[model samples]
Target chain A: MIEARGLTKRYGDLVAVNDVSFEVGSGEVVGFLGPNGAGKTTTMRILTGFVPATDGTAKIAGHDIFEDPLAARRAIGYLPETPPLYPEMDVAHYLTYVARLKDVPRGRRKGAVDRAMERCGLADVRRRVIGSLSKGYRQRVGLAQAIVHDPAVLILDEPTVGLDPIQIREIRGLIAGLADSQEGGTGHTVILSTHILAEVEAICRRVMLINAGRKVLDGPLAELTRDGQRLEDVFTRVTLSDQAEASAGGTAEAAEAAQ
Target chain B: MRHVGAIAGRELRSMFVSPVAYAILTLFAIVAGFFFLASVLGFDAQVAEAQQFRAFDYLRQLNLNDHVIAPFYGIMWIVLLFLVPGITMGLFASEKTNGTQELLMTSPITIWELVIGKFLAASLFVLLLVGMVGIFTGILFFFGDPELPKAASGLLGLTLVALSYVAVGSFASSVTRNQLIAFFLSLVLLLILWMLSIVADLGAGGGAIASDGLVSRSMRWLSSADRFEQMVRGLVDTKDLAYFGFMIGTFLILTKASIESVRWR
Candidate 1:
């Protein structure tokens, strides 16, 4: 479970994320859609406790992210846009280090790493150095690290960005299985951020569209689209209209402030 | 703490695997060996001259601490000043450059744990270098009558100085993602701190007592080499110990603050 209220991040005068708020129930697979600079990554970073929000409160499974960062961080398994890997380290060694970082008990570290590797389909290349792996394998390693600790919430930023179509399908299926099979098992709340709309259709249960650091649409995937209007059409209409309005409003505010 | 150990263990492994570790070790050994041999030959030359005047008493009068080991330790410290930056430049800078800092920042580990872990790992590399150079010192036991207490104190002093270097170098790395910039920043900071005593001495030109004023005294007290000199003299003054401890703690805190600033930024 995750909750964010009035989240705002300002880098000097530029507002990277402004008054953004969202929520997801336990075990929900939510897709976060946004244009380049739509504050998706910023919001995720704040939630993961990697960056501080200028104003707002975020609670991760009941622990406040800002006030109780260690506990909140302990509940989050975050995979940033980059895989965050050491090139010289082998896959298993890297995962074991992550297990230690996530505070997996000594007795269960190997089991946790093994299960993560198994779930991510990375057992065959366990001994191979991460640098020697292909991009697809590297991405799988990123996914394995995120699930190594079995955290309550998983925030994956563009999990399928560089993978091929087959790899993408496999990752989507893996995510789908994680959401469905874990209904009675370990309930993992996943927030996936991606630019690809079709990927969301394939795996996400709910979609939230954001533009210019503001959430433009939030609802069930089916509810957001009309009887005949395609999702792409809706995405363009909402995002493009917001972009025009933002440019016009921004110029007016700047002129007024200068005067 | 266990968290510190886990982080430290990974850091040490990564360091050992890098080419930089081997390069630093080999370079330090070669340079240290050069200095050691030169000191021994220079001492041997002196002993030969003294034996002509007093053949029986000359060997007994040879002061191994002053003639050979002290100067060898001095050269070792200088070697460390250059090699230490290499060891520490990538500690935090490479992590940030490669984007692994995000994983570290989001983990349950605190900034202090990360800073201390990396610092301790760098210190361990310094220890390994000392251990390798210790083989050269061990040779003194067979041919010369070196004072064991003095030799032990000198190694302790060298370790303390290496730790101070690591602390500052870690802070330098934390402030920037560019390894070259980190290396130069640490080098410049160290040179300035070491040179302060020299500058103070120059200020008291022709004066017998260099500690003539508060500014000079403070500069001498702040000089890392000055404290090391005392330790080399087998005088482990509380003030000198406190100075090394304070230097290490101050730089570590500064490093933590820089990392925290990145999150806030």
Candidate 2:
């Protein structure tokens, strides 16, 4: 469902996302693990068509992002690091607008919106203004937005980052449910980025670890943890390798540029 | 067009749902009303003086169109010039600051569609501002015998002026995430465009603008204020329309290009 070939991004002399590539098959949930400046969000942004790759190709369900961005983007449901939401807009109105932007048919919009809200557990706060909601509720709204159009692929960046423990668990269960066809949320190939190793352990079936813009590891989660080794020791053993130089600069630029 | 409508509706909803739409409308109406009242009082005083001195030449030529409507439209033109930047400053900048630009850009829409959608929303709001001018003119049709077409033409010109500023404001807003920066950038650009015609007429650039050399004529041709003044005189020249059309089209294209260039960076 997602294919990336030598995707790279550069700013001035800094290569924020180097020539890195990987592919995720349909309906597979992959965890993108990286440190503070591991180019995690940058890669996700490239895949979601939020940021253009400086070199090479990205395709969503066989549609090249650069060649036919709208089509490629249409198949994607993205939740950026910060939930892209309007503060003054209520939950239902905001979701409806996202539905329209994602090209849900006029007649089915209400149904799609209702299903997304129900899926995200946002029904209780449907009429509440987004700004007035707590962080967890806002995160759910962002998730609801991503799935509103029922896009085939979901690219979520740190969806559970700022939520409380219970909120995190709920969000994880929602994601896990989406990944499991038996849970009724079907056929969503998700690529979620996070620094939380336990998050990958909880929901993601595959692990793709990137460090300093290069993919250091990619494999089945079960195989990597087959020896009962803690994912933390493995992550530390790999990422703590000599590739940890000058990573902080990109984080600064990331916040500055995204703003 | 569907994409454009969706984006525009989102923008319009954001404006109206907050205090933004009401604030802009009420402020525009109050300021425009004061300008109308001032112009009416000035015209009445001028007419009374003319009649006292039996100045027939001045009186014969001095109708409401000349004394009241033209100056009223000019004041409205300047007022909108200041107000338009405020309306458009947050159109794109707020999206960036709030991170909504990420969602907007990632969605299935082209930059041209985004720009046009924003331009349409700003134009629609300015259309309401022009409607306020029409409401003020409603009182004129009652007691005064103003030339209907002439007054109507002035309002049309005001609308075009506001729209042209909208295009410029859209471009300005697209360039930055800071609302204050967007506001000042557009205000300065509009002021430059407003002053260009006066500067083009000085020194060796005198006589009719068309009779001048290419450089002087081009500056005059590019001067929106000059064309807007012509429209207020009840003259709807195709040249004026073409100038506004060309300017609006250019600025909107530039607005799209500015946003598109962000991906490259």
Candidate 1, lDDT over the whole model: 0.89
TM-score of chain B of each: 0.94, 0.95
Q: What DockQ would candidate 1 receive versus the native complex?
A: 0.87
Tens-digit per-residue lDDT, B62-126, candidate 1 = 78887888888888898888889989999999999888999999999998889889999999999
Q: Tens digit of lDDT per residue, candidate 2, span B1-265?
A: 6889988888998899889789989998899989999999998898899999999998888888878888888898899989999999998999999999999889998787889899999899899999989988878889789899988888888888889999999999999999999999999999989887777777344555544778677777788887777788899999888888998999999998899898788
What is the Å distance of residue B162 in model 1 from its true position?
A: 0.8
lDDT of 2 by residue, A106-159 (tens): 999999999999999999999999999999999999999999999889999999
Each candidate's lDDT (Cα)? 0.89, 0.90
What clash pairs does model 2 have?
none
